[model samples]
Target chain A: MEHLDALENQSIYILREAYKKFKKLAMLWSIGKDSTVLLWLARKAFFGHCPIPLVHIDTSYKIPAMIAFRDQLAREWSLRLIVGQNTAALADGMGPERGRLTCCTALKTEGLQLLMAERGFTGLILGIRRDEEGTRAKERYFSPRDKHFEWNYKDQPPELWDQFKTDFDADTHIRIHPLLHWTEIDVWEYIRREAIPIIDLYFAKDGERYRSLGCWPCTGRVKSNAATVEEIIAELRATNTSERAGRAQDHEDTYAMQKLRAKGYM
Target chain B: MATDIATPRASSNIVIVGHVDHGKSTLVGRLFYDTDSLPEGRYAAVARVCEETGKPFEFAFLLDALEEERDQGITIDTARARFHTARRDYVLIDAPGHKEFLKNMVSGAAAADAALLLIDAAEGVQEQSRRHGYLLHLLGIRQVVVVINKMDLVGYRQRAFADVRRAYLDFLAALGVHPQAVVPVSAREGDNIAAASARMPWYDGPTVVEALDAFAARPSREHLPLRFPVQDVYKFDHRRIIAGRVEAGAIAEGDTILFTPSGHRGVVKSIERWHPSRTGPARAGESIGITLTEQLFIERGEVISHLADAPRAGAELRANLFWLGDRHLAPGRPYVLKLATQEVPCAAAGVSGVINTATLEHVAAHEVAKNEVATVTLALKTPVAYDCFTDIVETGRFVLVDGYDVAGGGIVLPPVEDDYTI
Candidate 1:
């Protein structure tokens, strides 16, 4: 309980700080467990209201169940949802037939970039955990992106204590990651504690479950019998599988994540 | 038991720091391997990579997350990994001990609840080791566990461990850092890592795992004096809600809250929660919004506390600082001081007692160079509310922002009597 409470409080503090600092800020919701938990924490911080706008870059290649869950939550929670898509890329017949990296770059990163340009959102909150990947492990809680939307990973600014790099040039974009400290198991444990609703696709159906959710064509499922949050926690405790083992994009290359993240793939 | 399985036990962030080539990475790798914390696929994955590269597998290779670092066979930055004991979970922070990576080391150590200071038994104490010890103390890391690693290289003798331990302990003791335990470990040989080593028959002590479990989490700040910082004010619907996190103490309805530097006070009308019905006292670490009985025109960056025990309000304060900027931190250089929620223009009134961390000697310098720790007197343009870090850290710690980057971090020390030329 103490561990969950600690994680929750720190996240809430970060959310409040982001909300207080940035005038035009939005949160990216991937309809995954981590970002969903981030959404829940936003409500907790704002006292039942998500003051920040929620952004979802709908690549249109997502599994149908994910879209349904997103819509359902948007309507039920009365969220200020803004869905953006690379309609032009989709119109050009971009699919997995193209390179996965290029597809992701155009549909996800470029789509988000276009959305940011259109909305003029200065700050964006993401639910990226360090333990999820290697490049993510070296991230700062309040990382700033350049005008070209690149993570300057090589010479990152020093982030000491709770004082993050909040101030940036007018053209500089900031990415706030409140869940950077939470591990994959911690996310499941917090989900169990808070009883936060998640897409049922995570639960096992006929000996298979999605460990990490993404767009349909690029995603995979693992053999699992975790039909409930408690079962998932137990499975996580006993299993040696990485959380992103079922996510396909990460397997394309050794530095797939680093390359993707450097090009602004959150 | 099912509930216990469902809920995670409390965790601590432990940072492992030492000189480069002193086995910090090997120790971290061994800790995870010994505890069976590495996922089976991950272990096999690294081994497979080693095979492809035609290099023998090493425990340190388990941590080379980046391909560049793998090629160099060195950890260039800080990375965190998780391992659990039967008692609790641990977030093991592996910090690079290279001199060029001191900024990375500080970044890692700043977030840790405790530290594991590693020393090479065969090589004895090193320069970077002393620097790291000084930085740990400067960062206010109270709990430390000294690990004499690579004992097997010295034939697992107690004499090597004792000599290194005694020397480092004396140095750390001078900085007021008394370690919780001095562990003798050979990460490569797996001696005194998971359990007490059978080879070191002359030494009787808890193993590395046991010593780790013994380090307690940071003390609760609930009983301390109230020091809530007003982060922002929101007007949702019709009610005016003031939002902030209780950094030190608790706040309840009807408690008179004092906003500092502005000298405005108001009584708490109601404790606001998301449910709107769950009203209770908000304690330390809880982010809550409250409605005041009177609508006070208080802005962000004001410390809220009991009027009887408010923070020290002044335009100047002394600090023990560590500079991380490329440009030297010199006197009269304008920078932004960010303390809690307050941000104001400030300058180094005087930079003094510049410490060469490696030598532990006070070097005469007018400016602090990169990665150097020193004492500084900062002069702010305006008065702000703050506390001595020795008393309440949340309100006492601050960062110096040069342009858009966080260039330096420090703790508020008691004000000095001498004047600063600024």
Candidate 2:
């Protein structure tokens, strides 16, 4: 319980800082467990109201249930939703078949880039956790993205104490990761503790469940009998597979995530 | 969904610091491997990568995730990994010790509650060995365990272990850092990490894991006086909510609060929360919103506390700063000083007592360069509320923003006429 409190407080602090710092800020909502928790934290920080707008990049390949869940929650919570899609790329037939990395860059990263450009959001809040991937382990809480939406991972600014790089070039957008310090278990545990509603895809059905949700074609389900959140927590505790093991884009190459992230793929 | 996880384990963040090629990452990898903390197939995955590249397998590769870092054979940034023991969970932060990556090291060290300072037994005490120790003290990491690594290189001799341990301990004592324990081990060979080593019968103190397990988590600041730096004021509807995190102490309805620097006092009308049923006093480490009886002209950077124990307000502050900017920190150059939520344009009034961390020598200089430590007096454009770092850390620590980047971080010191060591 104490551990949860610390994580929750730190996240809430980051959320409030983003709100206080950026005038034109938005949060990326993937309708995944991590983003759902981030949405919950935003409400907690603003006293039951999410002040920042929520941006959802529609790859058009997300599970139907995920889209349904997103709309339902947005309406229920009175959240301002901004959906972005790369129609040009989609019309040109950009997909996993073209190549997972290329597809992610086009549909996901480029989609987000277009939305950010159109909406003119100076700061974006994401729910990326360090424990999820090796490349993510080197991320700072307040990461900066260039005007071209490129993550300059090679020469990242130093962040110490609770002080972050809030000051940035007007053309650059900052990526605020409130849950960067959290692990996979911490996310599931917080979802359980807060009783936050989640999509049904994560729960096991017929001895299989999607451990990580992404584009449907690229995401695979793991064999598990864990049906409830409690059982999922137990399963995570006993499992050794990485959280993104089921996501095919990461396995496309050794440094695939690093490459994709550097190009601004969340 | 349920309420919480089963058996909520305590998590401690421990940063590993040492000179370059001192086996910081190797020790972390070995610790994870010996404790069964690595995910299944992670070892095999690294082994496969090495095989594919036709290179020998190294424990450090498990953490040096970047291809460039692997190719360069050095960690460019701090990498964190999760491991667990029976007592608690650990986030081992592998911080680079190269001087070029000092900012990266400071970033890693600042978040850690405890630290493990590694020293190569074969190399004895090097420059970074002392420099990292000084930095640990400056960062206020009180709980440290010194690990003398590469015992196998010296044939596990007690003399070599004693030599490095003695030199490093003497240097730390001057900085007022009393490490928890100094354990001798070989991270590459996995000696005295998780298990006791038969190679060193002369050492019976504790293994690296045991030393880490002995560390106690710092207590929360709930008992201290209230210090809430107002982050912002939001009026989503008709009600104006003052939102901020309670850095210390707790606040409830009907509590009298004083906003420092402005000297405005108000009564707490109500403590606002998201969940109605979870209503109570907002304690330290909680982000909360509240309504005041009077609508004062309160803005961000106002430190709210009980009127009796409010923080000191001044425009001129004495601080010990560590410069990490590409440009030198000299007088007459304006920089943005961010303390708590306060951001004010400030200038270095004077630079004195500049210490080269590598050599631990005081050089008479008018400016500080990158990766150098110095005691500086800053002149702020406006008065801000703060306490000495010894009194309250959240209010005292600050960072200097040059142009659009955070250039330096430092802790506030008490104003004294004579120079003194902390």
Candidate 3:
């Protein structure tokens, strides 16, 4: 719990810094455990109120329960939720049947990019932990993207100590990650300690559970008997499987995630 | 490892630094392997790639995640790995040792509670061995363990280990760093890593893991004077709350606090939190909000300190810094100096000297070149609250930003009236 406390303090500090630095800032809520915890931290950072809006990219392939859970929490917590979609691409018959990468780019990455451009959002708060994936490990707390939303991982700015690069050039959008230092276990532990609400899909039912949540067509379930949060934590401690094992896009190729991230995929 | 029964152990961040190809990543990977820290299927997946590529399984491969780094067989950035011992858990930060990646090294070193300065026994002390030691001292990491790796190359001889240890010790002594221990190991052969090596009969000391577990945790800054740098002020509905992480000491309701650079003072009306479970004083490391009794015009980049022992405010500062920018840090050129939460436009008013990290010798310089360490006096546009780096690290350390990128980092020297010699 002490470790969780430290992680919480650090995350809250980052959240406060993001809020103070950017004028046009919004948080991306995936309706997953990570983003839900991020939403909770935002509330904690602002003291029972979240002034920034929450942006969710709806691919229309999400499980029905996820949208219901998102709306219920938004209403209960008084959240200003903004739902976006690439309706044009969706109507153009874009789905997993058409290459997963292309489908994700059009419906998810392009959707978010279009929404950001239309809303003139300069910064976005994301809930990405380094231990979740290899590419995420290379990210800075305040990562910058070009006007075209491309990530140049090779030449990232040097971030030393608590002094992050908050100033960016014109037409540059920054991705703010408060959970970069946390591990997957740290996330679950913090959730338990804070008693933050999460979707029930995480808990096992019919001898299977969702370790990571994404679009319904691409995300798969892992076999587990973790019926409670406590059981899930125990399973996580005992298992050597990667947290993103069920995320199909990551396993498409060795560099699938990296390529997607370079193209501004969240 | 049940969630309800497990008690969280104390965790420390340890950085691994040395010259490029000094086996920093291999040693880190071996640590994880010996400690069983690698997650399920990770090692298997890496091994599968090795088999498919017709290459031998390398411990360093565990860390080199990027395609370029893997193909080039070098660590390009700081990669973090988690390991646990009976005593504590450690976040091992494997920093690239190449001179070009010095910025990445600093990024990793700045957050470390302890450090492992690696040196090849066969090669003895090298340029980066000294450079990294100097950086560790500058970054305020007092708990260091000099790791003499690749003993297999030296035939596991005690003489080679002793010579390297002596050389590295002399270098560390020049920079005022006293290492906790000097360990000898072969990261490739797995000797003296997790278990003591029978190969080195003449050398009897704790293994690398034991040395790590022996490192003392950094003492808490609770008893120190309160210094909370205001991050932002939020108005939730009608109640105005000043938010920031308490860098040192503690703050409670009714405590009178003073904001620096602005010279405003107010009493803490109440400690605020979204969850009502926390109702007491907020200590160091806790990010919380407090409502002030008097409505003061306090903004971001202001330090909130206890009125009794307020931090000193000064416009002129003397500092020792390590430059990382491609452009030379010259006098009269303005740069943004960010310390704690404050960022002020500052210029190099005077340059005393620059130290050649390779030789540990002082050289006269009008400007600090890239990857050089120097002592200089800065003139700030406005006064800001600060303390000596030795006294309070949070208020003393700073980074210089050039053209929106972090160019250099330094610590404030103790205030001197006339003398400006390092």
Candidate 4:
């Protein structure tokens, strides 16, 4: 469909924007359908070769299949994969048992933060969509983060038309979300149309499927029998459930995601 | 309601706005729900959050999942959701409609292609509805499709829809917006949203979906000249990369581009995406990295482009402004001016005359309150690559920041009259 092509072109355009705007850049790969699609788009934006580093936060608690899939794609796609982790926190025994927010902060945010410092990265590309959560709604396509990685939610640059604010002050690194305008269904339909590779968790097995991927300890499965991509599309054509319903950290409080994101948690 | 328009190029972003409880969030929620765009398990995430926060679980979760929004039953920030008709992709921005969150509304409206102005059928055109319409006009959002919501609440009465439509048209006319069409529907009852409502068969206009699907992509002022707002100058490993979107027109390798405000001239050497080794020619709406053939220290917010059609470099610009700050604006006060990626210290050169947005009449000796639109003069300490808003909107738009916060938005007016000295 032309709409799909248009969305794809828009995403490729934004990806090209980020690549142009940032010098020491990296792309986040969650091993999910969205970021995987982002990875594929990045390759196309750069003419079949990903010039930026592929960053996958090794929370150390991710599902085993996710880690396997990550490595497999890294090899097949010739990706510059950089696995980051909160080694100190993980060594200190930070787990979901402590708390969902704390766990996510240490494993996800802290992991990325430490990686940025150690690697001297100034820009991060995420596959976050505005429709995924309310706090994400406040995000700019070219959003700037403070030195401390704090997001000033109340104070945002005016993004009129497509002219996004890309320049920033010293020590003020930015995060670019090229897929901020995409939705959950759009990602899948693109996957089906483009035939991008996805992890096994997304497809239902034994009448249960993991709709959203996260730490194995905290993620839950929902009822579904859509084993193939076509069946999944058909099922998605009729369901009302949110894509992130099974994730734990988003459920801790009404503003749980907001609070985490305000402190720079993805 | 289904009238998908064919789009061959990049799709435009459209935001839907109205008063709180007037179905701003509900309309977006319904759009996602009906399109089945809501991802799997997303509802359960909200349900779990609702169970934790003791909030009622419903489709509003699709928009207001933030704790503050849920607690207040209000939208505090601008939320974006996507929908695709057979013709084009639409980015639906659900803006907060409450008076307290007018700034959010302004930000949302700033990014839209066309606006769906929602009016409560029973309420019959309120103040915020008119205010939003006026704000949309000030922001230069030309296409408007009015939706008279809550028809079910009014028993699908043609009389109620007609009254609201009539009142809305008069208000919009006062604000200088002649909307393309006005449709009546019930967002709550799922009437005339994605499907035609049997109840409103007497109404001969397009439904919300049809209006959106049928709308054409408005072309920018690309043909007039070229304007590129520099977001930043990337200096990594000593390789200079001037990065930003081509706000209008296109750029090719070896084209002489001038950085405005800075008054620096350079030749285009190469355009790259993320790496130094890769390069190409960049076009409008696409962000590509550029390496100058002749390197100088160029910072963000400076407009870089072909020297042949370079925009005027100036410190002072006469402009139309939407004031969102609580404090009053006056001449001689310095606020932040952001053009593309450039943020510079700037002073309001003259109060000019504050005009009433609703009436479009100039008023003398008055302070602009929050949510007021006025014509003002801004004088920057440093030069910027800019053009008059009427001539080219790319370089003409800017945002004012005070103490690290964006205070208001601005559109460049015709160059200041000949008599002014900074």
TM-scores of the candidates are 0.96, 0.98, 0.98, 0.78
lDDT of 4: 0.78
Fnat of the models, one by one?
0.70, 0.71, 0.69, 0.38
Candidate 3: tens digits of C-alpha lDDT, residues B1-422: 32333555558999999999899989998999998888887898778767866789988878777877877788888878788876778999989999888998888888899999999998888888888888888888899998999999999989989989988898788777888888899999999888999999887778899999998887888899999998988877898989999999999999988899788989999988877435699989889999988899888889998888888899988999999999999999989999999989999999888999879889987999999999989999999899888789899989999987999999999879545433
Cα shift from native, residue B71, model 4 (Å): 3.0
Off by over 4 Å in 1: B1-3, B275-279, B418-422
**What are the runs in model 3 whose C-alpha is more than 4 Å off?**
B1-6, B417-422
Let me know the TM-score candidate 3 reaches against the reference structure.
0.98
Q: Please give the C-alpha DockQ score of model 1.
A: 0.65
What is the Å distance of residue A159 in model 2 from its true position?
A: 0.7
Q: Write the per-residue lDDT of candidate 1 for residues A172-222, one digit (tens) a residue.
A: 899999999998888988787677899999999999999999988999999
| Residue-by-residue lDDT tens digits, candidate 1, B307-383 | 78889999997998989899999998889999998999999999878988877788899899998888888999999
Each predicted complex: what DockQ? 0.65, 0.65, 0.70, 0.30
What interface RMSD does each of the candidate structures achieve? 2.2, 2.3, 1.7, 6.1
Q: Model 2's DockQ?
A: 0.65
Docking model 1 quality class:
medium
Candidate 2 C-alpha error for residue A202, in Å: 0.6
Computed on C-alpha atoms, the DockQ of candidate 4 is 0.30
TM-scores, chain B, all models: 0.96, 0.97, 0.97, 0.87
Q: What does the lDDT read for residue B151 in candidate 3?
A: 97
Q: DockQ score for model 3, please?
A: 0.70
Alpha-carbon shift of residue A13 in model 4 (angstroms): 8.2
Per-residue lDDT over A25-58 for candidate 3, one digit per residue giving the tens place of the 0 to 100 score: 9999999999999999888888888888999999
Per-residue alpha-carbon lDDT of candidate 4 for residues B180-214, written as tens digits (9 for 90 to 100): 88989888778888888899889887878889987
